[model samples]
Structure formats: C-alpha cells, structure tokens
Target: MWLLKKLSPDFKTIADFRKDNRGAIKRVCREFVLLCKKRDLFGGELVGIDGSKFKAVNSKKKNFNEAKLLCDIYSVLFLMI
Candidate 1:
C-alpha cells in the first residue's frame, strides 16, 4: 500500500487514484482476458461451468434477471405510495 502511495503524487485519496487510473485498469483487464484466451484457461467443457461456488458475502441469492429486478423495484414503489 505504501509503495502504491509513493507511485502517485497527485491523488490524495484511493478513489481519486482509481478514477485517474481507470484507463490503465481497463487495459490491464483486456490484456488479462487475452492472456487467458491464449492459455486456454477456460477448460472447455460443460462440466467446467457448473463447478464453482463463488458468491457474494452478503447474499445466498444468486444474480438477478431483468424480471426479478423489475418486480423488486415495483414492490418497493408500491409500498412507498
């Protein structure tokens, strides 16, 4: 963290540093994706897709689709009215 702090002299906050380096972050992500593709890290099999259990710390619920999101928002708005 201190080494990263030394590297940036203009930014006062971590958020500021991240905002300034957004392009660099994007470039790094693109390069990482290319590298993964080149190395065939995806293990091309149907079995590979369902073998993970990574979820957010707060929610047992998986990601929401458009309908679920609309329903949730409508319910909240209905309650407020």
Candidate 2:
C-alpha cells in the first residue's frame, strides 16, 4: 500500500483498493507483453552473462552507459507504454 500511495496520490493505499484490482494489473501486464511480442521489441536472446549485482537507480558513476543505462531506460519506457 505504501508504494501505490507514494507513487500515486490518487491511490491512497493498496488496501484501499479492491481485491479484484489484481486481475486488472495482471491483464495490463499481459497486454504489454503481447504488444511487445507483436512489435518484435524483445531484444537479446541470451541474457545474465555479466553476473554483476547492480542497483537500478544508482549513481551513474558506477553504471555503464551503453550497457546499463540503455537497458534500464528501455525497460522502464517499455513498462510505462
């Protein structure tokens, strides 16, 4: 609930939302995946080669530009769309 509230003021809390909201969230996620699949936007057939533990929103000094930033930005934008 803290997350939903903090991220969206309109949503006071997750508990304040109905139990059935889970279905809506799941459906939206599925629809996004389907859309990406249709657009052939899924890149990198092989992953998990680096084996480096990194924070998503950490300082840029520790993260790679062409590698980490590009991947992170794309993932975030894809989810938002």
Candidate 3:
C-alpha cells in the first residue's frame, strides 16, 4: 500500500518510543479526557483525580495532625521508660 514514503517501524523501535514518552502520553490522555468532558460526553459530573495513594475511610476526620503526632510520640516515649 502506498500510504506514505516512510518505512514501517519494527517492534523494538515502537516499544522504545513508548518507554521514552510515557509522561507525554499520560498528559495527552488527560487532555483528551478533559476535552471529552467539555463536550458533555460523561453524561453527568466527571471528577478526574489521581487518588491512587489515598484511602477512603470513615475515620477521615481523625487523620494525622500535629497534636495527634505529638501525642503518639509522647505515648511511645512513656512506654519506653
């Protein structure tokens, strides 16, 4: 087929290209998602957040704070004596 003048790339070349531009690919994906959302493709509200490291729990209000950290440190020090 006479689609273009450039020759077809081999598997290794394709793989290396992907490995080198992974971040760019992810950003492009995010932009595509935003464009789709602007076009009202999500049907309802769409919240795109990268929360892989966060855990959803009932004790969210009791999460880490300076007072809690200091209390834990004091308790551990008292236990060691």
lDDT scores in order: 0.82, 0.77, 0.88
Every model's TM-score: 0.39, 0.40, 0.46
Of 2 and 3, the candidate ahead on TM-score is 3
Leading candidate by lDDT: 3
Model 2 TM-score relative to the real fold: 0.40
Where does candidate 1 stray beyond 4 Å?
A: 1-12, 44-81
Candidate 2: where is the Cα deviation over 4 Å? 1-11, 44-61, 64-81
Clashing pairs in model 3, backbone N/Cα/C closer than 3 A: none
lDDT of 1 by residue, 1-81 (tens): 686876755546877878899999999999997899799997766653666787655453756879989999999999999
Comparing 1 and 3 by TM-score, which wins?
Answer: 3
Every candidate's CA RMSD: 12.6, 14.0, 12.6
A best-first ranking of the candidates according to their TM-score comes to: 3, 2, 1
Please give, for residues 11-69, the per-residue lDDT of candidate 2 as tens digits.
55655564659788888999998999899999838655678885687565765767777
Residue 30 shift from truth in candidate 2, angstroms: 0.4
